[model samples]
Each structure stands twice: as structure tokens, then as C-alpha cells.
Target: MNKRFYIIFTVILVIYFILKYLSGFYIDFEWFRQNNGLSVFWVLFMTKFNVQAMFGTIFIVLFLLNFLMIRILGGKGRFFAENFLDRINIPAIGSSRKLLLLIVTAVVIFTGFVMGGGASAFWKEYLMFKNSVPFTGFPADPVFGRDPGFYVFSLPFYKFLYGWFMSTLVIITIFTVLLHVLNGAIQKTVRGVDLSPFSRAHISIMLAMMVILYGLSYQLAAYELLFSQIGKFYGAGYTAVNANLLAYRAAEVISFIAGALLIFNVFKRSFKLPVIVMLTLIPVYFILGVIYPALQQRFIVVPNELGKETPYIQNNINFTRLAYGIDRVEEIPFANKRELTYADILKNRETLESVRLWDWRPLKQTYKQLQELKQYYYFNDVDVDRYVINGKKIAVNLSARELTIENLGVNSQTWQNQHLIYTHGYGLVMSRVDRITSEGLPVLIIKDIPPV
Candidate 1:
């Protein structure tokens, strides 16, 4: 009774704290509704809560389905968990199973909620993928021939799905196998490991599912080659395009066929085919997926890297330029033959005449000394710029005289000094780039404070 009372009290306290924490979101929601329109708040509300609930429900449903399947196939009464089931000294067998079920169920719910909550933070990623706008009027990737939009908008969603399914499959398989083993459907014999006919057939189906998932993973890896940093530059270079691409395709095909064969093995008396196929797959994977790619990269591409990688290099240049939104810039190779002449100078006289002579690196310090009237005024930069003044283009040096309040004496940095006394920066300081005073300071056109 005392143990039961403590448990009840702990449950009540946990519920109280959870409610208190959730109450904070209620205040946030009310504020959002008032300040940010109801529609805006609702959109954010639905995106987070709805997405989280949806994916979380999927995890729970999967667990429940696998749990039910195990119960049904393994049969309840025939469980061989003797002597308290893993040393759990419960008084009654039924009570022991119920307690174990409760713990497992709680763990499943907690894990599902956490995983789904994290997944839903990327709601924007899911939304973008659902309504992806293809990038138009751009050169596609040379290897896979996909638009930039595919990688930006779609790859993340596919990867998330892969992870979601793969993790769930792994968990389900382990749980099912363990439960079946506990039910005495699978055991160790003097000869070797033994399996009941029903267990063998049921487990065979799961093996088929895993093989199919592997096929999907292999196919997805093909797209990921574009992001590979296997060469001089990122994206599909020589080895990736020529080697990894072929390997992944072949692996995926083999994976699919192997999955089908595993399913067929269930009908046969003995499971010889699956073991053979699994063993064969490893060496085949190493050859087609590893050794072949390695050989192709070393023997084929390395010997004539420049010639082979030239086309890929050009592809990289185009894609890199596209990434920076400067794809439209025209490229023209420089010719070494022509010598620069005065006529060439005369042709571009406007550009030549407006060139800045002053370097900004030392000019900023000079401005701080010359133009900072009060110690607080600071010239952080000297910028070279052009001005069209009365039918003439003139180049000039400009600097914003920013008020650095921290430079004031510590005691004088009071509220009034910062806000009221030095409320704003004085003004801009300007000068001609080519001109210098007798003291070797810049000749000032827009001088600050008291004139010298």
C-alpha cells in the first residue's frame, strides 16, 4: 500500500509540472493571436502541432502493429519464459506480462513523441518538397541531369523518409525476433540453432522487407554522389560519375532481386537460398561497390586526370557560377598577343580617369586623427566611390563618422551622455582620393567639427 501510494503521488506531481510547463505555451499563443494575426498564428500552430502529431502517430501505429503481430504469431499461452522471465521475480505470470507490457508501451510512446517532435521542426522542408518548383532555364547537373531545385527542395525529405522507415524496420525486426525466440519458436539445439516452421516463415517475410529497404537505400545513394567531396571539387567528379554511379545502380538491382528471393524462400522446406544470397551479396557488394570503383579511379582517371577531368571541371565551373547567381556572366579567354597602348587607354578613359589612388587600410586611421572632433567620433572605414557632379564623373573617398560611445571616460558614460548628449553621429567625412594636404593627411572636402 505504501509503494502504491508513492507511485500515485509521483504520477500526480509529474502531471502538475507538465501542466505548468504547457501553460507557458498558452500565454505565448494568446500574445501571438493578438499581435500576429489569427491566420498567422494558426498557420504556425498547425504546422508544428499537426506535423508532430501526424508523424508521431505513425511511429505509435507501427509499434502497435508489430506488437500485435508478435502476440498473434507467437501465441500467448505457449510462452517459455520460466523462472520469472529474465530473473524478474513477479509473483504471478499474467501480472509479470502486464507489467512488462506497460513498461514497453510507455517507452514506445515517449520515444515516438520525441522523435516526431524533432522531425516536425523541419516542417518547412516537408512543405517545400511537397510543392517544389523546378528550377527553369538553368543547366542541370552533368552526372544525374537534375536541377538545382531537386537537391535544395527534395533530397532532405527523401532522406528523412529513409531514416524514419529504416529505424522503425530495425526496431520492429529486433522486437519480433526476440519475442519469437522467447516463445520457444527459435532455440539452440546440440546440432545448431533451431527454428519452428512458423517462426522461419514469419521471419523470412521480415528479411524480404529489409532487403527491399536496402534496395531503396542504394538507389538514393546515387543522388547523394552529387554532394560527394571525392575529388578536387565537390559534386560528381571523375570517380563518382564513372565508378560510384555504376556501383550503386548495380547494387540496387541486386538488392531488389535478393529481396524477392528471400520472400520465395519461405515456401520452401529449408532456408538455403537466403543464406547463400546474403553471403554472395557481401563479396559482390565489395567488388561492384568497392573494388571496381577503386580500380577505376586509380588506374583509369589518375593517369590522365587533366584530360579526363576537363569536362567535369567545366561542369563544376558552370554549376559553381550557377550556385552564386552569376551564371549569366560571359566568359572570354585572354589573348597574350596584344600589347596595351594609349589608344586602348583613350577608349576606356572614363574608367581610367576615375581610378582611386588612396589605399583605405591606412586612410581610416588618418581620418580618425584628422576628422574625429570629439574622442567619441570614429571613422571605421574609408570607401572609394564615384559621384556624377555637374556633367563630370568624380571619384572620392567617403567615411561615415560613427559615434563610438564606449570611447568616452567610464564615469562619463552615463545614461544622459549616451542617449541625449551623443544621440547621433555628427555626419559623414569626405575628401578627394588623389589630394593630400601639406602635412601628408588627406585633403578634406567635407571636414568635420572645428576647421583648421
Candidate 2:
């Protein structure tokens, strides 16, 4: 009951925080103004019904994102490590002590990576716990990627066994609690020597391994798997710090500290030099992995789908819908209704070229106008004769024309002037003039053009 209450309370608090931060409400008046403006509070509060509404929206968005990523990636989350030892899968009944240790290691690393690293990381997470608009984005890369805190937390191993169940804090907390119970059970049932004995020399060696492995994983695994696979090859890569490297170093440092504690717990055989080094490094690592990565992953560069990277949404062509242009309008004689005219077509081609075009002319005028206006746009027509942005043909009729918009006749109830910059553009931006607030919700704006 106590744990359940804690869980429920935590969830509510998280939702509240996201609303407070992202929605821009505040107890501190100065912070709110610095972030946006004092007017943001009354405006957002009136717009959204408490923080729960904001959370509901975010949950839906994240779910859609996860679903889309799974479809495109062609695989479920990683289930186990790739080494030969992992192939020997015994069902839940026959799991051994070694397997348990391995699993623990994997869970710790996964948690660390997701959390982030260093004192600041933990502090951010703490603040996130207290306040909630997550200062970060989702951490899991569709491509193979891990964070620094994950590395620090999952010390002494690079095994990928826990899968996606342990990816989030809620899940990780459950796993941690379960592990505590399981560890107690193992200690009682199995009476033997501690297999992992640490010495001054052993500690030195592990440190070396951490450095080597971190370097290799950064240079090879993370760069090759995560960054290169998506960024360079698919033209979706961003130049940034390597995630794998950060994870690896953080994990190694954590393990070193944990190992030191283990040395103290055992009946001391020999004590020569600086044993305290382990304590400093381990806790620092734990702080780094558990607190930092979680905090860091939340540090998002914005999702491409949000129309930051590309302002258009493209989908596979539907063959049945393609009949609009090819089949001419059928005229009705008795009712005196016009036949299925090509000009009245509702598909991508006519939608872009005829109805949606602000100027209703060829691509030349539209392109030239946008260039002069210095406004960015997107098109829904995939086969625009000789124009391209980011190598994909424009799929909608869109323009970046300047419009001196005012709030007097817009959605906002205030009479104010503002430049309506869109976040989701396309034809939607052009047609739904009313829906485009002076602050612009980004018109999913697509444009269509005549067949090239």
C-alpha cells in the first residue's frame, strides 16, 4: 500500500511538473518571465485544463512516436546480448546465479545510461522530480545508442539483456526493488566464495578495461551503430557527442567504486594502499549513471516529426486515391451538376497545383515568392518537376509568404500583433487560416502542384 501510494503520487507529480514547466506556470514570477513571459501563465491556464490535460497530450504523442519507431526499425527492442554465452537460454525455472549477476549488471548499465551523469545530471532529475516539464526528450534511439549514465551504472560489462522493460525510471525502479529482493534470496541460498575478488592490481586492470572498452564502443559501437546508421547513411545523422562513449566511461567508473565497497565488506585479507579511491569513483559513477543519464536523455534536440528538422509529413502513396487526376469528372445531365472535373480533384496533385496554391500558378512563381519572403515551407506533391528539399520531392502545396497577422480576428482573445511562425506547415497552413493562431500551430502545411 505504501509503495503503491508512492507510485501514484510520483506519477501525479510528474504530470503536474510537465504542465508547470512546459505549460509555463510558476510559483516564482521571475522564472516564468525569463522563460517566456508573465502573460504565458493566464493564457496557458485558460487554454488547458490543469496539468493532467498536458500530460494526456504528451502520453499520446510519445505512444505514437514509439509505435512509429518500432514500425520503421523492423525489430522489437534488444532482448539479449549477442555473445555465444547468451544463446544458451534456459526458461525462467533453470536460471542460475551467474545469469542473475549478468542480468543485474545489464540492468544497472541500462539504468545509468538512461539517467545521465555527474552532479548536475542528478540535480536536474531531482528538479524534474520536484517540478515536471521534462527538460529533455526521450532517450531510446531507434538506432543502437546508450548514454553516459547508462555506462556508469552498468559497470564491468556491456551486455544487452534487460530489453526495453527497464528503459524508463518507473520500470527501472520496479526492477531495482525486485533485484534487492532477489539479491537477498541468492545470498541466503548460495553459500560459496565471492567469485569477483578485487585487489589493488585487479582494480587497476578494471580501470584500464573501462578506458579501452569506452574508447572502442564510442569509436565503433555507438558511432557505427547509432550515429552512422541513421545520420550518414539515411541522411538523418547529427554531429554531436558520441552517446556510447559517455555511457561506457560512466559505467566503468561506477563499477570501480562498487567493487571497492565489496572489498571492504569481505574479511580483509590484505590492506596496503589507497582503498578509498574505489568509494569516490563508485558513488560518483552511481550518481553519474543513475542521475545524469536520465537527466541528459531528457535533454532533447527536438524530434524531426515536430517539424523542426523537416517541415513536412510524407506517407506512402495510396493507389486507390491516385485515380482522382486520371479519371475525369463525370457530368450529370438531369440534376444539372458538373461532371467529375479534374480542376475539382481532391488528391495530392490538384490539391497542391490548383486549390491550395496561394497564387494558383506554376511552381516558378511560388518558389520565387518564398525565396524573396525568407519564409520556409513544404509541399505534399512528391514529384515536383525539378525542385527538391533534403532530396525528397515536395508532397504538398506550401508557401512561406509573409502575412501581417493580428489576434483581433484570430484564436487568441487579445487584440495584439504577432508574426505567426508555423511549427507544422504544409497545405494545412495555407487553407486553415483561422486555425493558424498568431503564434501559429504550424499548418502541417502541405502544397500540391500540377503534374510535371
Candidate 3:
């Protein structure tokens, strides 16, 4: 609305564009190739435009809506705004100089604590990922070994923290502003009334409860799913697991009830029943919901698992085989003997011919050169697997993964592009390893799934 504000905004836009160009240039530089960690910071900084745009849009819409609402409400709204601003200024808090100093001090202290904690956690995990000895697990590709090309070359952990920090700060700030607006609106509507729907204490408690609920939601959801899956497979020693799951669910239900009661009390200004319930539930939750289950699992479940190892082993084998599609293979049991026969070789020719010897690293490069349809469609890695085709076992090379729109280019990663236009990647590109087309491309065996 002012010339100074416009000047500052324009300067920020120019600086951001300059930095964006620099980041892209640096990514292609040989220096960046040698020092990948430096690129992480620049990439994270350049990629923050979308998040900034989102929060900026939210702030602008809220400001406009507040202005329109006040205009509709007439003189009362103007008077309320004036009174609110007046009350916000602390009485006899000394001169403007002192007030500015105090504000600066408070900001420094607050940011120091917040940023210190974030940096500590970030560096701890960064070092862990950086110095980690690669091992076989969910995140590791078994065929290619532990270190996937993506994990080895990219600073995913740093990028994740950067995104999390930016999004959390933006969301929290937006919600805080919205909450302030709502409080002011309520106060304006109930002019001169003693009873308010939301007191400062009530808002503070609710905010704290929200953070707790966010953490509990993830914890409870993960454990609930784990126990449910375990119950489906291992029915023998699942009673303790079931009891532990029930305890967790019960705790979650009680926590939700407590939060609801707190909200209800905020509006009704009721007696301290909600406070009493919350206080009581905390201990009850600790005892019945946490301790009891742990004790039961330790005493009953451990002994039972030890005694009945065969069933548990069978369940594990069944689940693992099913998960990896090992059970789908045609199994033909044969007697072991000191023998070397052409008959055995003939019988197992299908399996022998399906053995993959082509290195994936070079194959990935070849696929990128020949198969990539567009800039967005990336061929990151090659996977080799044997499949029964027309009653014959054949090995196939494919890359099922595709880069997200955000990874395609910054310009193509608008809100609609990310959230709507292309929410997920296209399907796999597959071909027989030993075959080539006339144009020197891998023989197209199975193209994109869903036909497009």
C-alpha cells in the first residue's frame, strides 16, 4: 500500500530470481559435483518460492477478508479495531526507544532457542546419514546393494529438514494470525460482555493439546497398523499384542475426550471438571495404557514365543515369501545326490537362462539416453527380475520410478501442477534385456501401464 513497501517487495523479488539462477548454475558446475553438500543449501533456498507463495496468498486473502468484514460491520468494527490496538500497547512501558529494545531482546531470545534446537537436530541427523555404513533394509535396494545412487549423491536429509522448517514456520504463523482474528471477531460480536468464548488460558491449552495430538496421531496409527498386521499373520502369541494395541487405542480415545472437554469448557466457562479429568487421565494412561501392556508382553508373550518357535517361524516364512512373491514361483522338489547329469541341466534351462549378468549402473545410463520420453520422465535405475511369460521364464529390465513434477523444473511445479495436474508419477517402462529394436532402443515389451 506504500511506496517503501513496494520498493522492498520488488527488491526481494529481484534478489530471489538472482539466487534462483545462481542455484541452477551452481548445480551444473564441476565444483558442485565434488561438494554436493554445498548444493543442498542453495537448492533448498531456491526451491522455497512455492512455499512462500502459498503463505503469501493465505496472508493476503485473510487481510482482504478482514477488511471486507470490517467494512460491512460499519462503525462498530472501526471502534473495535482502535480499541484493540490501544489495548495492545503496554501502559508506562517507557519511551519508544525502550520498547524497541525490549522487543528486539525478546525476539533474539525466542529465535535463539528455536533455531538452536532445530540446528542441533538437523546436524545430528545429517552427520548420521552422511557417515552411515550402508546396510540392507527397506530403504536399500537389494540387487544394487545398500547405497542407492539417489541416497549416495543427494542430501535428502538436509532437504527434508529445510522443507519441514519452512512449512512448519509458515503454517504456525498463519494459524496464529487466524486465531488472533477469530478472537478479535468474537470480542467485537459480544461487545461489553463479561463472558468470552475463548480466554487466553483456553487458547494456550488448546494449542498445546494440538501439538500433543499431532504426535500421538502418528505414534498410535503406526503401532495400530503394526499390531493389526502381526495379528493377521501370527495368531498364536497375539493376545498380548492385541491387549497392548487396545491400551494404546484407549489412551488415544481418552486423550481425544479430554481435548473435547477442554474445548467445551472454553465456550461454557464450566467448573473445573475438564481440568480434573485431564489430571486424572494422565496417570491412568501411564499405568493402564503403558505399564500394564509392557508387563504383560514381558511375562506372558516372551515365554510363549520361546516355547512355540515353530509356528512363529512358519508364520514369518509365509509372510516374507508372500511379500517378496517368492511363493509364486513354481517349486519342484528333487532328491539331492552326488550327480552331474545333462538331464538336470535340461530340466532347469529356463532358470539358468534367466540369470541377469548386465550391470545396472550402465543400463540406467543407456535407458536414460534411449527411453526417456521427456525432461520430467527420469530413468533413475534399472531393475532385473524373472517372470513367467508364455510358460517360459524370462528376465526383464525396467525402471518403475519417475521424478516428481517438482524435480522436473521449478517453473512447472506450481500448486496445481504438484497437487492436481500430476499428483503421482507415470507407470513403469519395461523391456527384455537381450533384445534391441531397429532404432537401437531396448525392445519395448511392456510400455506405460494404464496405456498412457
Candidate 4:
């Protein structure tokens, strides 16, 4: 019987591990390499909501409860062990079921390591991404803060076992192993206690009930809601992964509570006071920890492009800050869609140009704004800076070198200075550059401008 259980556990673990490595596990690392930082929430969700989430959650909780129950009852003078077994006159587990469970769990975990593609392309990519410098999209800091008491709740045990990623796979794998041990112990305890068929049935039904509740709490309900929320908001890409880390922390709390509750339910006869207190206090603590962050105000970056000198809001908007009045979200424009093209190409490149070199900027300029004037204004021949239409060769005087409607008018696109832009069609070549050649503005028609 023990050997059969071991085989079943091993098969399940191996299948899951292989799935983990194949499902783009290393993309997280690739993201960190390109983006310059890791978002733990993102990776957790992707791994958790997989098919394994369903089976793994339920099995682990019941398995652990079985172990603790055996340990408490197996001891001399334990209430349930003394009361129930005394009345039934049945043999409790003569041998340790916990040990059998441990063996099965070990086999399953070993399979996970072996079948999960022993460090292939995914591993390599993850390593590269982690080693590279992190990328920051915004010009400011963007990592979310963690709760201080998180480590307090997750202290010496769970942390020591998993070593940090705190993923569902690791959680499931760990709890599953523990469950096997407890399940074996409980079976042994029943045999030693000498319970009847009816009692056995009663126990089995109760165990099943606990399993279902724990499953819903640990795997299905808590973590799924959080991860699903993240996926819906963040989009299914590496850039939007930070949301998953928050969900993982929430899931961890659920696991801890479910484990506690299972033990309390099994040993309802003795230690009832302590169990009740733990049940009440622990849940309240976890609930507060989860809610505090959501209540506090957070900084969010909102980006858009519109007409303005600088569109970035330069203040923090928090709960207290809101009382004084402030925009909830700040907007910053990354780029402008405005286009800049040359004005005139007709009477040499120097003769054709726009009224201003760069007019896309909101700054307005007039002819009087020129501090210095020059008859012959030269531009960066290699890099076209500015152009002159009627100015002659002379030194710049002053007045910031401005211009007016009298000195310059819109040039004709089809002027004589325009190049013959040819188009070969039906044995005819059309001049495509004529409009743009003389006057820089392609939109201007030859008839619109007065003849020079």
C-alpha cells in the first residue's frame, strides 16, 4: 500500500515540474534583463493559476491535519486518544503513517526536480535577465513597498524550506509532502484506536470536508482572485508582472491559516482554548495587514501627449495631500506626433525655408524678435538649420535678426526654381517634387501664392 502511494505521488509531481519549466518560466528573467527590475507578483500569478493549482491545494491541507492529529493523539493520556479509543477498543496505528507519507512526498519532489527539464533554455534566460542591469520606464522609482510584519508571520519554517520565490508550485510541493506524512499517521492511529465501521465513516467524511474547505481557501479562492485581477489590469506580457507578487503574499497568509485551522478541527477535544485563540488572533492580524496597504494612498504615473511647455505634474498626491487639493493621477507626455519637414528647395537650398527653423515648439516668434540681422544668413550645410528668402550677403546688425510678412511670403510649390519631380506613368513623367521643391510647404498650391 505504501509503495503504491509513493508511485502515485511521484508521477503527479514529475508532471507538474515539467509543466512549470515549459510554460515560459524563464521569461521573468528575460523581462528583468530588458526592464531592469523584477516584479514578483507577475511571476506568481502565471505559475499559480495553472491546472496544478486545483489538486495541489486540497491534498496538502488534509495531509498536514492528519499528521498533527496523530502526533497529539498518539501521545500518552491525550483526550481524544484516551476517550474515543478507550470506548471503541480499537488498535491505533501500531506503525507510524507519518513516516510512510514522508517517503511518498520525497519521491514526488524528486520527480519534480528530475522531470522539470534540468535547467535548459528557460533557466539560462532567467539567469541572464537577473544578472543584467534593470530598465526603468519612468524617470523615477517604481517598486512597491512590502509589509514589515510579512517576515514575522512567515518566519523560521516556511521561509527556510522554500528560500523565497514563494510560488504556488513550491507551496503545493511542500504541503503535499507534509500531507502524506499526516495521512499515514492518521491511518495508523485509527487502527490502534480500534474504532468501528461507523466511526471510520464519520472520520472519513469529516476529513473530506476539511480537505474541500482548505482547498478553496489555499489554492482556488484567495490567490486566484488576486492573480486574475492582476492579469486583467496588467495585460499578458512581461512588462506587467509586478502585480503577481502582491497576490503571492496574500496566498501565503491563506496557507498559514488553513494549516492552523485543520489542526484545531482534528484536536477539538483538547487544547481547544489555545486553538480558538490562535484562530481568532491570527486571522485578524492577517486581515489588517492586507487592508492597510490598499487604504494608504499610492503614487501612479499617467502619461499622455498634448500641447504644453511641460506636462508632468510635480507633486505627490497622497491621502493627506488630497485634502489640500491635487490631481489623483499625474500625466507626462513621452513624445509629440508633430512632423518637421524642409520648407523650400527651389532657388538653391539656402533660398527656400520656413518662417522659423523649428515651429513645432509652442514658443512664438515674430520678425521684431530678431536681436541681430544679417543680409546673408547661412545654415548648417551638413545639417540644415535655417533658411533665407530675399536677404543679401551682409553682416548681422542687431534686433535679434527677426522677419515680417513684408520681407517674406509663402513660396510657390510649382515655382520655376522647383525641380522636375518625375513620375513614369503611361509614357509620361510627372513632376512630384515641383510643389515641394520651391516652397517647403507641400500643402501650398502654385495658384495660392503670388508670382515672384
Candidate 5:
């Protein structure tokens, strides 16, 4: 029985690893395949792998090293050796907690590696920020003095880096404090928990990084005001530009000062200073980050919304047009003449003949009913477009025929039938939009299952 179990487990592990390897290659070829070649795919795959490995190593190494430093070096007494196993009459992990250590280390490694994989998705952002080029011949945004591409190509990676470091530090800080408690570095005194100077210094330095990132968060949020949905329109409005932007700058400065103070406390090795600094951040965030902006929006911007938001509205419009590459569009004036002569009729007859009268909603249903030759062939939509056919520019309604195998009966909808035999639907149904039959049906320009 043991031998059979081992054989089954071994086979499962082999198959699992094989599937993992094959899936990586499949996804690499399918999702990537940039330039339809192997090099780009390999580059992307390795980039992701390298990033994941590097960050994963950082997370695990930092965790393990810190754990060793505090638990092994700084720890005292049998507290560090304590495990939960003995409480329930289970065999206790040895005084060294070797089993507990192994379990904790495994959990931390798994979490870090999984987090690294998720973070790897931001590689494009990193690459873009690294290789960010200035836009040519394009005007900068009126407020930021940055090209439109800065928001698109740069900001995301900065935000991600900030978040990653902040999260890592916070996690490490919590783990360190917990470990400190488990050891005797932080002992429960008569008054409260008494943190040793050594633990205080370590935690303060960790918090200094967090405070700095916290400050930087406001700065990032400043740029993100352009994408804010709190207002009537997207982008910075009166309160945001007038109050919120200024407030973010102030918060950033305050955060930097606060972070520096925390570092100063690390050297002082006094828990009091770091506590005071962190306690202040709550009110600072609420007042400057939240309340100030809300007050400005409610009191000032609300009274004269049109007057306040006009400039911002214009900015949104200009940026939107710029984003879509329609900023240089030319407008022509047209004369609204009511009467027409016979010469006018003859001159514009070709254009008049191409005016569409059929709406696509009913036309799609009509195509599905009449031209859809098979039940599996689905006409998704009727696309109205122009094409020059035989030297005449004509308007036509076209519907691409696609497969819907789910419409097949249960017995007929087999995997082999779906994947191999009837894989895709071919051809499109097309007709001149203006030319309708006597019975009000479309005049077929191109028809049939094989596509005429």
C-alpha cells in the first residue's frame, strides 16, 4: 500500500510539472508572440521570470534575515521556542521550534512568490517609465507641464513601486513586532507593553520608509486628480486644482518631514517620538487630504459651478481631443438652402442615392432570419460602411457570419465537432443599404453560404 501510494504521488508530481512547463509555453506563444517570432516571446517570458524571482527573493530574504536577526540574535528565554502544538495534546515541536519555523518560512516564501507573480504584470509600466520619451510637436497639458504620455506611460509604475515598498515594509514591521513580543524584546509590563530600545530602533526605521511612501502616496494622488470621478466631469475641477492640489503638495512636504523625524527617533531609540509622529498622520490626512478638498468643493465650487469648472471643462475637452488625435480637425461651413433646381438634383444625385434609410437593429434580425443559412452561423451585427465597387462609391450593410456552436443539440455539440470539423464560420452577407426590394427587404449585393 505504501509503495503504491508513493508511485501514485510521484506520477502526479511528474504530470503537474509537465503541465506547468507546457502551459507556460502555450501562454507565451498565444498571448505574446510579438512580431510573430520566438525572440520577443522569450524576452517577455524571461523579463517576467527575472522580475518575479528578484522581488520574490527580496521579500523572502528580507523576511528570513529579519526573523533570524530578531528571533535568533535578539531573542531571550524559552518564549521564542514556544509552539501551539502542545496545547491540544499534540506532540510539541522541539524547543527550537524547527517544525514551526519550517511551516512559517514556507508560508512566507509562498506568499512572497505569489505576490511577485502578481507584481510581474506591471513590467510594461516599468519598461515604459524607464524608456519614457517626450512627445514631439504636441503641446503640454496646461496645468502639469507634462505631455499627455506622462500620465499614460509613467505614473502607473511609480504608484506600483510606492505600493510594493509600503506593503513590504508594513508586513515586515508587523512580523518583527510579533516576533519581538514572542521573544522578550517586548514584554507585557504592569502599565502596558514595554518595547526595548533595540526593537524600537528597528521598527522606527521600518516605519520611516512607510512614512516616506505614505507621503509620496499623496504626491501620486495629486497627479491622479485628473482621473478623479468625484466631480461632474473627469479631470481637476475648481476645488481640486485650487485646494486639493495645493493640499497634496503640503501633505507631501509634511510627510517627508514626518519621515525624517521618525528616522531621527530611530537614532534617539525613543518610542515616544515615532508614536507622536504617526499619531499626527491621522488628522493630517483627514484635514488636508479629505476635509480641505471637500470644503472647497462644497463652499466655493458649488456656488458657481459653471464659472469654476469652465477652464477645467476646456482642459478635459482639449486633452480628450488630443488623446484621440482629433485636435487638428478642420470644420467647414455649410449653407442651409431649402429650394433646389433640376441642375442641383442632377449634380448631387449620386450622393443622394447613397443615403441610408435602414437601421441596423432590424436589419441584423432580417439577415439572421433570411441569409443565415445554418443554425450555427450567427450574424453578430450589421456594419454600415462605404466601399467603391466597380467605380461607384456605394454605402453597404455588411454582417460577418460567425459560429455559435452552443446552438447545436447536446449530442451534436461534441468536442471533436466543435474543435476539428466545424471550427469557424466563413464569409459575410452584404447588401446595398439604399436599395430595398418591393417587399422592403435589402437588395443583396453579396450573398450565399460560401460568400459570393
Candidate 6:
């Protein structure tokens, strides 16, 4: 078993590396680039170089190493068939199943709350957005309200719930398996404490539950992903819109029902109903969630483009304008006089003086050398804005886009820096464009002073 495991692991690693390299080549291909337009391939390529992927890779490797170490320690010659093979009924940790369920439920909810930034942040942001909006009606947003506070709040909760369910299921299943494996190995090594082996029924049920939960999680994730793309579906015409909506909504409903059934089966300690549901529902899901949508797009949407696309186009226009606050901007026709007077040039002297002659690259470097007080807070860009200073409107060059501690690379970002120390940005460095001090530095109008 050890040898087989080693061989399989090595083969999988080799295949993974080969595919990883091949993916690089595939992404660089012109046809692939044109067809995909920076899709999952791009995301994978970028993620490979990130800290999260590094940590994830390290974790998997560690788990594999642990398995190898355990196998090596428990030599084949020391194996006792009677002790290892005999099925033992291990009772629940708690007094009753209900107690176990309650503990699990609490843990899952706590995990969700922590991972989702707690209820305080959610409600605070929701209320802040609701109060900030000037007006509320259909023009502001068609579905939810003027602001997307409800949608935004609900999105994180949805993610949290899904993550909690999947993670809890995975942890429990892995713990059960690991407990059995470790118990066997311990029994072989130490002779003092007698430990019960996992019963066949318990093992089978745990494995089945894990598999069912995994499948349900994956299907639900697909539903979530599809549903989230509703905003991007606006311009795709009525048929395409209808098809995608139907597909995602149907997937979500079915996935929810299937998930509920699985939970029911878990409590009942029988996989019959859940198995039947999975077998029946998956094919129907494939048809409605995949095939029907494709057929609708290919036949109905693509053919009647001019006729069917008008309403969708209007929706896209209206929603986009509302979302972006573009409808509020007044548009006036401009008739260029085609004449510039001396008075006009004098009137716009501040703007003309602000026309930057110095290259931003050198200016940024100089600003960093002279102005940047902290190492973490560095200037990213140099901007020019007109400010009223000392009863005179003057164009001032500034470096306001500071890279705060939170803006540092992912490896450097900590919870403390992200949430506490770096809640807001450092103040800007503003200097008059025309004025220069004796030391050849631009005269500082506004230095490291944050907004009042």
C-alpha cells in the first residue's frame, strides 16, 4: 500500500507539473488568447505566483509527507491483521447525537461569522450605504433599491454559509478518516492504551457523506458563480438573458433541495433518499443548466439579434447609467468659438501653469527622496489639482496615491495592518507648481496633513 501510494503520488505530481508548463504555452497561443480573452487560464497563471498558492501547495505536500511518515513507521512486518481488521463501534464524543449536532452547528456558525467579518461590519456598511444615497426609486436601481446595500450584505453571507457548510463537512470527514488511520498506527507502535477501530458502517457512512457533500458543494458553487454573472448578462438579448436566468435559478433551487435532502439523510443515517435524489437530479441539471441555455443562445438569441436585443440594450443603458451615476451629469452642446484671446489665457493662468513639464517618473522619485516620511507609505502617482490657497486659486502638483501598509504585497499584509493600523490612507503631499524654495524643492502647500 505504501509503495502504491508513493508511485501514485509521484505520478500525480509529475502530471501536475507537465500540465502547469503546458498551460503556459496554451495561454500564449494566439488562438487561445483570442478565444478565451484572459479567462480562468489567466487567473491560474497569476495565482501560481501568489502567496496563497504557495501556502496551499505547502499544506498538501505536508499532508502527503505525514502519510508517508506514518506508513514508514508502521512497517509491514509489524502488521497485526486481527487487531487492524476487526471493526470496532466508536461512540460519539458527546453523550448524545443531538449534543454532537449542537456543537457542530455552533462551530460552523462561528466559523462563518469570523470569516465573513462578523455581523457588525455587515450592518455598518449596509446602513452607511443606505443613508449615503440621495434618492431611492426604480431609476436608482431596478431590483433591490437605490443602493446595493442589501445585495452586498447578502453576498458575503451567502459565501460564508457555503464556505461554512463545505469546510465543516470536509473537516469532520478528514478527522474521522485520520482518527481511524492514526489509531491503527498507534496500536501497532504502542501496546498500552487499547483503542477501538472504526466500525465498517461508520466508515462507509462518513465516506459516502463526504462524497455527497463534495458533489453538492461543487454544484452549488457553480450555481453561485452563474448567478453572480447576472449583471454581465444585460446586453445578451432577451432569449440569452432568459436562458441564463432559468439555468442559474433552476440550478440554485435544485442544489438547495439536494443539499437539504443530504442533511436529512445524515440525520436519518441512511443514504437511500439522497442517493436517489442525486441520481435523478444531476441529469436534469445538466439538461436545463447547460444544454438548454446553449441551445437557446445558438437558436433564438443569435438569430433574432436586432429584434430581440432592443429591450436588453435599453436595460443595459438604464442600469449602467444609474449604477455609475452617469444619468446625473448634465450634457450641453459645445460650439467651439475657435478663437483664443489674451484675457482667456490670463483667466486660465493657474491651469496653464499646472501643465506639468516634469516627467512623473523623476518627480515621483524626487518626492520619495524628499517627502515620504514612512517606508510603508510611498507615492504611487503624481497628480495635479487646482486648490484655493491664500486667496489665490493655483494649480498644485501632488502625490496623494500613497501605498499604505495595507497596499503592500500580500505576504506583508496582516490582519492588524489591514483592519486596525491602516483603516484610512496617509495624507497627501501637495506643492505649488511654479514656486520653488532656495534648496530647489517645490514649495509645500499641503504636506502630510490628513483630511479634517
Q: Where does model 6 exceed 4 Å of error?
A: 1-147, 174-240, 256-273, 331-452
lDDT of 2 by residue, 407-449 (tens): 1345543333233443233332233221233543323344333
Evaluated against the true structure, the overall lDDT of model 4 is 0.34
What is each predicted model's overall lDDT from 0 to 1? 0.78, 0.37, 0.54, 0.34, 0.81, 0.55
What lDDT, from 0 to 1, does candidate 3 have? 0.54
- The residue pairs in collision within model 1 are none
TM-score of 5: 0.66
Residue 290, model 5: lDDT of 87
Full candidate order by TM-score, most accurate first: 5, 1, 3, 6, 4, 2
Residues 322-420, model 4: lDDT tens digits: 434443557778897765554433445533322323232211122212211332221111111222324633111111112222222345334432334
Q: What C-alpha lDDT, on a 0 to 100 scale, does residue 186 get in candidate 6? A: 28
**Relative to the unseen true structure, what is the C-alpha lDDT of residue 288 in candidate 5, on a scale of 0 to 100?**
95
- Against the true structure, what is each candidate's TM-score? 0.64, 0.21, 0.38, 0.26, 0.66, 0.37
For model 4, the superposed segments whose C-alpha errors exceed 4 Å read 1-106, 114-184, 187-290, 293-452
lDDT of 6 by residue, 321-391 (tens): 87688988998999997899999999988678777555667778878887776666788899877877778
Write the number of the candidate with greater TM-score, choosing between 2 and 5. 5
What would the TM-score be for candidate 4 when compared with the true structure?
0.26
Segments in model 5 whose C-alpha atoms lie over 4 Å from true places: 1-37, 68-108, 267-276, 330-339, 346-452
After TM-score superposition, the amount by which residue 33's alpha carbon in candidate 2 deviates from its true location, in angstroms, is 48
RMSD of each: 9.2, 23.8, 21.7, 19.0, 8.9, 20.9
How accurate locally is residue 77 in candidate 6, as Cα lDDT from 0 to 100? Answer: 26
lDDT of 3 by residue, 318-360 (tens): 6567658788899798978768689988998766666554467
Please report the candidate that would top lDDT against the real structure.
5
